[model samples]
Target: MRLPFTHSKQEPANTRTARKLCWDSRDEYFRCLDRIGVLNPNDPTQKSKINANCANEDAKFDENCATSWISYFKEKRVVDFKRARALEEVNRNVENNQQAKGSQE
Candidate 1:
């Protein structure tokens, strides 16, 4: 299968790496499709129809790609969320400490 996009030096290192990883999984995904008898199209409409109804949870091609990307971003998101929460907590503590100091003064 041919991917529509090409890797470029202008892209971020993370973006390039993610693209490569997904492309690496392409062969495994194709083999899975083959085993499921969906690799070779009997009719073009069949492929489109399957795609139209496809779900990421189904673990098919779309599913695999979707989940892989989701997993990748989810990890990043989790880390970002944690960092944000930590910062918020630190700010809150500082505000509380300031309030306590102000009241004591």
Candidate 2:
């Protein structure tokens, strides 16, 4: 599932970073699906129906890849949140120090 590209200027930095990471993660699945020659069962060209009992190796691997992508984003979100928070804290400390120095002078 290819996500639509957004060109909105008002989007936040964290959002853009998360989106890029998610897209990159999803791309791995797309690449694996292509390599495995797995076609969507709904496609008109796919005459062989994939049944629940009939386990398709490619399909199973694709599902695993999807799960990996989800996990990547989950970890990425936590890291991004921490990073943004750390930056905010550093900036606040710097501002406070500058204010203190000005008051001392």
Root-mean-square deviation of Cα positions for candidate 2 versus the true structure, in angstroms: 17.7
Runs of candidate 1 exceeding 4 Å displacement: 1-69
Error of 1 at 12 (Å): 15
Tens-digit per-residue lDDT, 18-98, candidate 1: 566655555454444445555333245556644544333224333335444545543554475578999999999999999
Which residue pairs clash within candidate 2?
none
**What is the lDDT, from 0 to 100, of the residue 66 in candidate 1?**
45
Least well predicted 10-residue stretch by lDDT in candidate 2: 46-55
User: How does model 2 score by TM-score?
Assistant: 0.40
lDDT of 2 at 92: 100
- lDDT, candidate 2, residue 66? 43
Please give the lDDT score for candidate 1.
Answer: 0.51
